[model samples]
Target: MKRVDVAYVLLFDEQHEKVLMVKNKGANSSYYTLPGGAVEAGETLEEAAIREVKEETGVDIEIGGLSTVSEAFFEERGHHALFFTFTGKIVGGKIEILFPDEIEEIKWMEIDEAETYMYIPEKLNGYVKTNISIPYILRGNVIDKG
Candidate 1:
């Protein structure tokens, strides 16, 4: 059986009609995505979301309700990740590049502009226009026997 871990996808800055996203480093370099990471040991999903956002972007955000959940499987790595997507609001601190190694750049992107980015998933793109607030839990490609 593969190991499963939880993560979060956060959307913020409705005022500018933009969402805060980060450009990841390493082999998948130049790929830009949301500001979030793995949930650390013993930390709640919300806590992990808040912590990851701040650690990656240097901004404190008031996490809003759950938006979506997704399960991603990495066949080569033999691991799966279940993600909880949430809406967040900037509460304090200025947005700055915090973790350069993990994050290459931080930017605000309009809905239309985001489509050009390679990291934004296909399923998530529709939500930008629908304006529907619903929690979505996505199962990965792998089938579960139980």
Candidate 2:
């Protein structure tokens, strides 16, 4: 299978009470997820995280720590996706829909309220509590890595 690299950021307010998220405006979707996307060539994971957030939300952020690294196989996409997630804080820039065609909406929702609309819930679960996290590398529900 082919391989892909993706980087995401978990940005919260100064009080850590709210998170930045974006809603999809696609023809067949009603889910909101963190602001992030693919890592382009020659850009570091941190750089990609910063760029994706800006493109999606028009917000500049200061990346903190590497919160998680995960890998998943997608039968539909025919590829193994490697994900790098980091913690960040909004340091500058105003929140705006830079890409209206791609995003239905963007907002700062309370951390607790985000549970209802976040598309990839696993990506955010227990996220802020740790500096590093990795999902089980498993096959057939059996742990495949230590």
Candidate 3:
């Protein structure tokens, strides 16, 4: 059986038509993506999103309702991930790049331009098309037990 993990991809509204995003680190470091990470054991999905957003962007957020869910499999990495998407509102904290190792830079871009970013997963693209200004969840694949 393959390992399974949960992650959140946060979308912060700037009170305009633009949304906040972060340039991911590691192999796909060049592409920009939402600020979120893995869900730790004993934590709820919403808790993980709030924690991840603060940890990655240094901005505290009020997580809203679920928007989407996606299951994905990484054949090359031999891992499965279930992404839970949540809508969030920026409540407080100064915007700063907190996780330098996992994120390169934080950027605000027009909602329409979000697709230009390579790291915007395909599952997210669907939600973006429907709801113009809401955060979404993507719950990904479960490991197949044989």
- Candidate 1 vs candidate 2: which has greater TM-score? 1
- Report every candidate's CA lDDT: 0.68, 0.73, 0.67
Question: Which one wins by lDDT: 1 or 3?
Answer: 1
Look at candidate 1 and tell me the lDDT of residue 122: 70
Across 91-127, the per-residue lDDT of candidate 3 in tens digits comes to 8997898778878888887776775552456666644
What are the models' TM-scores? 0.77, 0.76, 0.75
Which tens-of-lDDT digit does each residue in 7-119 have in candidate 1? Answer: 55456475747778888886854777778888878876667878988888888876665665667788988888776666666778788987777788898887667645524
TM-score of candidate 3 versus the correct structure, residues matched by position: 0.75
Model 3 C-alpha RMSD vs. true structure (Å) is: 7.4
Name the best candidate (by lDDT): 2
**Model 2 spans with C-alpha error above 4 angstroms:** 115-146
- For each candidate, how many residue pairs have backbone atoms clashing (under 3 Å)? 1, 0, 17
Q: What does candidate 2's lDDT look like per residue over 1-146, in tens digits? A: 88888887777766777878898685677568788888888876767888999999999986766656778898987989888777777888999999888988998887767645533467576545333434422233422121
